[model samples]
Target chain A: MDRVGTVGIVGVGLIGATIGLALRQRAVAGQVVGVDIDAQAIAAAREIGALDAGGSDLDALRPADLVVVAVPPDDVVSTAVQAAAVMKRGSILTDVASTKAEIVRALDERLAGRVRYIGGHPMAGSEGRGARMADPALLSGRPFLLTPTDRTDPAAVSMMTEVAERLGMLPVLLSPDDHDDLVAQVSHLPYLMAVAVVGAATDRAIGIGGPAFAGLGRIARGPVELWVQICRSNRAAIRRSLGQFRRELDRLERALEGEEPLEILLQRSRRRAPVDGVPLDKPPR
Target chain B: MDRVGTVGIVGVGLIGATIGLALRQRAVAGQVVGVDIDAQAIAAAREIGALDAGGSDLDALRPADLVVVAVPPDDVVSTAVQAAAVMKRGSILTDVASTKAEIVRALDERLAGRVRYIGGHPMAGSEGRGARMADPALLSGRPFLLTPTDRTDPAAVSMMTEVAERLGMLPVLLSPDDHDDLVAQVSHLPYLMAVAVVGAATDRAIGIGGPAFAGLGRIARGPVELWVQICRSNRAAIRRSLGQFRRELDRLERALEGEEPLEILLQRSRRRAPVDGVPLDKPPR
Candidate 1:
């Protein structure tokens, strides 16, 4: 039930504009302001009624009680630091980057006591890009991961939790490193698999490909630059996940050659990736 | 425009039942009969109006002008041979199996010149299984691949093309070997990738996994026994595709490690995958 008086959103891209729309439409914020380097993006977001006021100035974030930096993954830490410089004392600063460990550590070291810094990653997105494709309901019913270190203010985390609920998201709290590790296994690894599939299948295979191939290759069409940064930011965890994937791939190859049991491997995979049943993974404590 | 006087469908499972529904609903056949080893499957197909007549005897196929064998991949050749035995001379025999080369070769040697056999692979399916989940609309607007060799009759191919069109499918003609090769790369390889992803992520990462992971893992939840047969049937092509996949995966790993330029690889992948654009792959000749 706790609503922020004013919210400032940096980068007015898909996630940023979506959050702005959700906050404004759900009455979670008294005023929603957006700041973007691109004036056209700011105008596009404001035209969609996602922002009460928005401009291409850091000054626009000054009156806000909370600031959400929703830039590209590589720019997250820098944008948060810049937003923090303009944000008033006692205001909370957070980000919507896909990776969290590096960002959280940098922000904690730079602006720990000066301003409340919390890291966030809302696990929701559309294949479509930009503020024009932004939807208020995109955040609803999705897991909103909050990566808060020991140095992060508890009040900031609580406020973000309330905001996530107001936007109809299931807020999940975890340490920054844990967030990075888990997402590497689930999100980043799957994305890389798509990329590899697209690369391997090439034009020849894609021509005759069916719905299954299309479904598997869906995320391969995502923005490359953003994904590159995400991979770079979470290199160690992604590498570990890729190693696991290689071993699994080897098992599948061995099964195909009749050296291993195919049915058992497939049955185990089916259990791990349930189609309709409740997931088997343990929830974060 | 060419309609079969009587259509016999063996194996009233998902694909078979769906084909029956399409034929019956679209008025593509004068009479539709189904025969399955499981009496319950025949009843379920009948309940859904997928068949006008169905039983557990091969004698039901004696009057059929066209017999479609829609059993598991491993059973496809055997069922087709069995169906051919009861089918009157000059009757066309086809199948709706995922793999075509082995079955086509086996049938050509066993029933060549005796019965008209054209191999078929409908590029459509749902995650849900059995006759109860069958949909008439499942075959509509999907690619229905027909594999015919020099021994295949032209009239049989034409009749099958008409049937595909009547069911609202895009009929594509290819050699049995080509059909197996393409599907191995597109369908079978993607399925393996999903299996590998599930095996790698396991239950530990699935708890916080989002839509991307779910999308990539969708086919991993498919029937294991069926997939095992599919893999066994198209082992050579699938192994080749896996090799290509491993090389691509190596490139991705190198990209992640800053050993390769990531953006170029991603841009090429985006072009190949083609989320909303006309796919870069050449259409079947």
Candidate 2:
């Protein structure tokens, strides 16, 4: 946003609205235009001053110098394509999708030369959803993963990094492959495993859900529709992550069944202890 | 403890010291004797007002109306056997061990007709250890599982229930099998999976441990020695629980592989939402 005059935001949901709010609060965007399929989300985004103007149409993204596609993974590629077409010829498009590899591939195939694209993932979110849950400082001091393929414009990536920094985020560069692989194990699989843990509970145990079980299973309570799409989009990576979990669990199980000591596994896990700055230690509700 | 004059707490660590402090604060026992292999723990117990008197000798448990075995699960039966033999014949002996089936079985064989034994477990704790982390209200308004077979004295069970109530607990009656099954799935399996989740994390993901992964993996960071004993002692139940987890996770993975909707699983897991009583949400330092 250093030299960019206008910014366009598509799909003004939680992440979308938060980015809009943070950018507006920092005056990073001279004019912000918000677009959403949900009229209420667009209206709410405008009500919170997250945008200077809002519309319930894709055409609203036309006037911006830069466009940010803040949609769910399933919608990210399509939204990126739409925003890329609507934006000015030289304008860049980026996405805030959890899974970057698929979106980056799609962008490379569709809009490689016509328009530049960078994949972004702000490694922060809550179990909560909607524009109502938006906050201006939600991205403050958080890591924003900038995943760029060989096809991505270098200048666009640098400008996006500057914008990320201006909005109070630490922009860390990663390949689409590395980003997806890391998040699958750290984020996606953790969410699915939470579901498995809760689902594995007996009826009586469900009725008597203790702290450990409840806390571990909290992320399973997030939006099912969105996660279903995420799971579908990143099926291979998530499955691989789950497989890793099973293998480790199987090894521990073997040790346990054979009455062998659990010292090694226990020691390995101790590294994830109550360390400060670890979001996992203080997960959002 | 209505008629009981003195209470003996063997292994004066977090749980033991918390029980001692709660009993003393409620005036449930005229005197609370703390016994531990660790001399510093006994000294800390006395210093923190969790103990009315403290000693490191096994004979310290002999002069009490109720001798409470508060050792690790692996040592629960052995400690109870020692405490049962040392205490007065008519005096009741209860344990604060997590696994009830094994300890209850041990009591039926060893103390039957010779000394009354009630299997007790307070279903509340933090990750922190030692008397320094003890809280008088640790068990307040939390579930306390009581496993008593037909051979257990009715009066001893009733008195133990009263004592649990005095310490601000809701005494829930569960058979050894029910207790073990419930805790295996609800408590033990969750902890083991936390270890597995952390263990499965790649070096990069571990370095980027987000809130979801860290929060889900929090229990993995707890003391290893105690968990090794808990894992070994409850091997059968925990293994079965891990199997249940594996099956559920496999089903989810299959669903993902098949590109099937996860609405039902996600909805089911939402039941484990944020609850105030859960200590996993607020783990000790």
Taking the tens digit of each residue's C-alpha lDDT, what string does model 2 give over A1-285? 354688899988889999888888888989899998889998888888899999888788788878889887888877788778777787888888888888889888898766777888987777558787888666777788999888889978988999989988888899998988888988888888778887787666765556687676566667787888877888788878887887888788777876555787677677654353352333212
- The digit string of per-residue lDDT tens for model 2 on B35-132 reads 99899999999998988988888788777888888888888888888777788887888888878887799788898765788898898888678999
For A1-285, candidate 1 gives per-residue lDDT tens digits of: 567899999999999999999998889999999999999999999999999999999998888899999999888888888888888987999999999998888999988666798999998998878999999777867889999887888889999999988899989998998899889988999888888887887565677668778886678878888988998899999999999999998888888899989999998877778442236443224
Kindly report which residue stretches of model 1 are placed more than 4 angstroms away from their true locations once superposed. Answer: A274-285, B274-285
Query: lDDT by residue for model 1 over B90-183, one digit each (tens)?
Result: 8899999899888999998988867899999888888889999999777777788999999999978999998998899889999998888888
DockQ of candidates 1 onward, in order? 0.65, 0.43
Query: Which candidate should be chosen as best, given lDDT against the real structure?
Result: 1
TM-score of 2: 0.89
TM-score of each: 0.96, 0.89
Best by DockQ: 1
Quantify all predictions' global Cα lDDT against the true fold: 0.86, 0.80
Considering every candidate listed, which one attains the maximal TM-score? Answer: 1
> Where does candidate 2 stray beyond 4 Å?
A1-5, A25-32, A46-49, A58-63, A113-115, A136-141, A259-261, A272-285, B1-4, B25-30, B58-63, B113-115, B136-140, B259-261, B271-285
